[model samples]
Target: MRDRIFRRGILPIAVVAALSAVAGCSASGDTDSPKGSAAPSGSRAGRVDPRSAAALRAVEQATVRAGSARIESSTAMGGMLSLKTDGALGWSGDQVGTLRITYTGGQLAATMRALSGASMEARLLPDAYYAKVGDTFARRLNGRHWIRYGYGDLATLPGGSGAYLTDQLRTTAPLQPVRLLRACGDVRRVGEETVRGRRTTHYSGTVTPAALTGEDAAGLRKQLEQAGVATETVDIWVDDRGLLVKKAEQGELVGGRMSATAYYRDYGVQVSAARPPAADTADFKELMSTRGS
Candidate 1:
C-alpha cells in the first residue's frame, strides 16, 4: 500500500468499516465485539411466555455471574467482510480480554492482508484497546507495532461506526448476548438441542432498537434506527447449568446483510490483557495528525 493512501486515512476507514459490521469490535486486540443479529425464532415481544421469561432471566443472571469465558466467534458483513475470532473475555465489571482475529473473506480482508497478513492479536481493556500491526506496516507507523484506539477517540469516527463505541465498551463483555436476549422480553424456549456434545436449552427472540437494554442502549437504538433495522433475530443456547453455550445473530445494515455466531466455554476462567509497550504504541489519532504517520 502506498504511504500516501494509508496516511490519507485508509486504515481508519478500514477500521470503521470493520467496526460498523461487528457493531463494536476492534480490528486487532479489541475483538470482544459481542452482538450479531439472527433470524427471529419465536413469537413477538408483546406475548412473551412466563416460563420462557423466567428461563431467560436465569440465563442472563447465570452468564453474568460466571464473570468470564473463552469465546470462539465468526462474523460476516454481507459481501463486505468476514472473520473468525478466538479469545477470552472477562466482564465482572468493565470488559477486558484478547482475541486472535483472522480475516476470512470480503472487502475488508484485502486491507487486513496488506496491514497484518491473515490474522493479528487484539487486546481489549477498560479505557482503550490495541491492534497489532505487521512489521512492514509498523515501519509506516514509525516503528510502532500497536495502534491504540481510545474509547473517547471512537466518537470521532466518520460514520455510524462511531455510534456503537459505547456499546462495545459496555457490552462486549462475555455475557452480552444473554443480557440482550433477556432485555428483549419477547422470547420463547426453542426446545433443547445438543451443542458440541452437551445438552442445551435453546431460546430465540427479536431485538428491536427499542427493546435494547444494558450498556449504551440509546446509542445502539439510534444505530439501528439509522441503519433502518426494525428488528433482528437472536438465538442463544444455554447449558443445563444456565450458562450460555452458543449464540447466533443475523441482521441487515445499510451496507448489506450481517451475521455472527459465537460459542462460549470455560466460564470462571481468569483472563487478562495488559497494555502493549507504550514506546511501541501509537494512538490512532496520532496517525491522523498532519505529521509523519
Candidate 2:
C-alpha cells in the first residue's frame, strides 16, 4: 500500500486537473498515434444583442491574433483538490507550453505529497501532455520519469477527463472565452472594473450545453453532458485593447462543484515546450496494457 501511493493516486487527480482547467496528465509516442483533436461542447445558443455580440467578436479576434500569454490560475473542485498553475501557453500554433502545477490542498494533495511533495511539471504539446512526477516515478515506471497522455488515447477512456481536457486544450485559446460568451446570446456588460490594477470591462453570462451555439456546439453539448456539466457561469475581463485579461468559470460536474480562475498577461509572448526524452517517459496507454497483461 505504501509503495502504490503515487501510482494509484495519479488518475483521479489528473482528471481533476482537466475539470478545473485546460490541463492534465498523460502521453507517449511509443503508443499507437493518438486520435484527433477533441470536439468542444455546445447548446442551441441564444440570439445575441447585436451590439454586445459585436463587441465580444472583437475580443475574440484580438485575443486569437495575439497568439500567447503568461498565465497564473487556481482551481478548486469542491473538496477534491485545490491547485495553482503558473505557466505560459501558446496557441499561435499547436498548443505548446509548460506549467508548474502545485497541489495546494485537498485529498489529492496528500497523495501527491507522498511522491514529489506538492509540485510537478506539466509539458504540453498539441499531441500530448507529459507529467514529470520526479525520480520516484522514474524508478517505479521502469526508469521513466514522465508519463505521456496522448489526446487521441484519452478520448477512448469512457468516463475520464482525459478526453475533455484534450478537447478543451485544443479549443481553449485566449480568445475562447469571448467566443463562448458570444454563444450565450445574452452576455451582458457588468460595468468597468480594475484587475491587477488595469482598467477593464467585465462581462458575465450563463452557458449550458443545450444553449451553446456557434463553432462545434452540438458536439460540445454532448461531450459536456456526458461529463455531467449541466450549466456553467462564465465571467471574463477584457482590457481596453479588446484582449482577454482574466476569466472565471464555475459549475458542477458529475463529481462535484468545480471552479477555476485564470489571469492572462503579456500577450504575444514567446512560449516553448520541448517533448521529453522518449526513453525517460511512459505512455499511460502502454502502462495500462502492461498492467492488464
Candidate 3:
C-alpha cells in the first residue's frame, strides 16, 4: 500500500506544500590552502583560467562558506515495503519525514524524525526535544533518551537494522555537519542526468569512519561489522543551480538487502512557520535557549 502510493511519486507535491526538507551541497572543513602563483609584474589584467584547480577550489569553498542551513529530506527504503520490519532500519522507501538542521559557525544542531503512514512521529534532537506522538508527550534532555524515547539516529546507519546499528557506532561522536560531508568523500562528477524531467549533475561517493566512539554506537558497529555487511554507495543528482534534486543509496539491512532512492525537485530552502525550533516557541524563552547549547 505504501509502495503503491510512493510509486506515484508524491515528492514533488510534498515540496510544494513545504513538507520536504532534505537538500544540501557537500563541503570540506577549512584547512590550510596552498597559495596560488603571483600574477606577472606590470600586468593590470591577468589571463583568467577557468579549468584551474584554484578556480574549482574557489567555487567549492564558496559553497561551503555559505553554509549553516536548514533543509528537508525524504527517504524511502525496503523494510516497510517488504513487511519484514516496521522500517526501523531507515531503509523503508515509504518512510517519510522532515529534518531541521542548523549549522551555526560550523557546529551542527539538528533534529530529524520520521512520520510514517501509521501517524507516528519519531524525532531525534541534537540537544533536548519533546514529542507529541499521537497525544503522548515525551521529552528527552540528551542523546540517551533517543534510544527508548525517540527514533534511533537515521543519518549514521545504512539500512533499517543495519543503520540503527550504525547509529550505535557513531552515537558518541558529535554529529557535525562538516563531518557528514567529509564522510561523503570524493563526489566525482558523473555527467548530467535528468531527474523528474529536470537536468541535474550526478555524483557518487562513500561514507567514512565505519566505527566511532561511545558504548551504544561502538557495540552496534561491532555487531554489523562482525555480520560482514558491505559498505553503502550513495548517488546524488544536483540541478544546474547547484541544488540537490535527487539521491539514492544501495546497502544492506539485516537479512534483507535493498536499494533505495529519493528524487528532489522544485528545491527551495525555508523554515516552516508551523514547525519552528524550540527557541521560537512561546514558552521557549521561559524554558531554555537553543542558541547557547
The number of the candidate with the highest lDDT is 1
- Ranking of predictions according to TM-score: 2, 1, 3
- TM of each candidate vs. truth: 0.84, 0.84, 0.39
Task: Arrange candidates, best lDDT first.
Answer: 1, 2, 3
- Lowest lDDT sum, 10 consecutive residues, model 2, at 24-33
Residues 22-43 of candidate 3 have per-residue lDDT tens digits of 2211111111111221112223
The sequence of per-residue lDDT tens digits that candidate 2 reaches over residues 198-286 is 99887766667677787756665655765577777667778999987777766677678776777888999999999999888888777
289 Cα displacement, candidate 2 (Å)? 0.5
| Residue 12 lDDT in candidate 1 | 43
Backbone clashes, each candidate: 8, 13, 17
State which candidate, 1 or 2, has the greater lDDT. Answer: 1
Report the C-alpha displacement of residue 195, candidate 2, in angstroms: 0.4
Candidate that beats the other on TM-score, 2 or 3, i.e. the better one: 2
lDDT (0 to 1) per candidate: 0.67, 0.66, 0.30
Single out the weakest 10-residue window by summed lDDT for candidate 1.
24-33
Write model 1 residue lDDT over 78-126, tens digit each, in one string.
7877778787888888778887888899876887777877887887798
lDDT of 1 at 87: 79
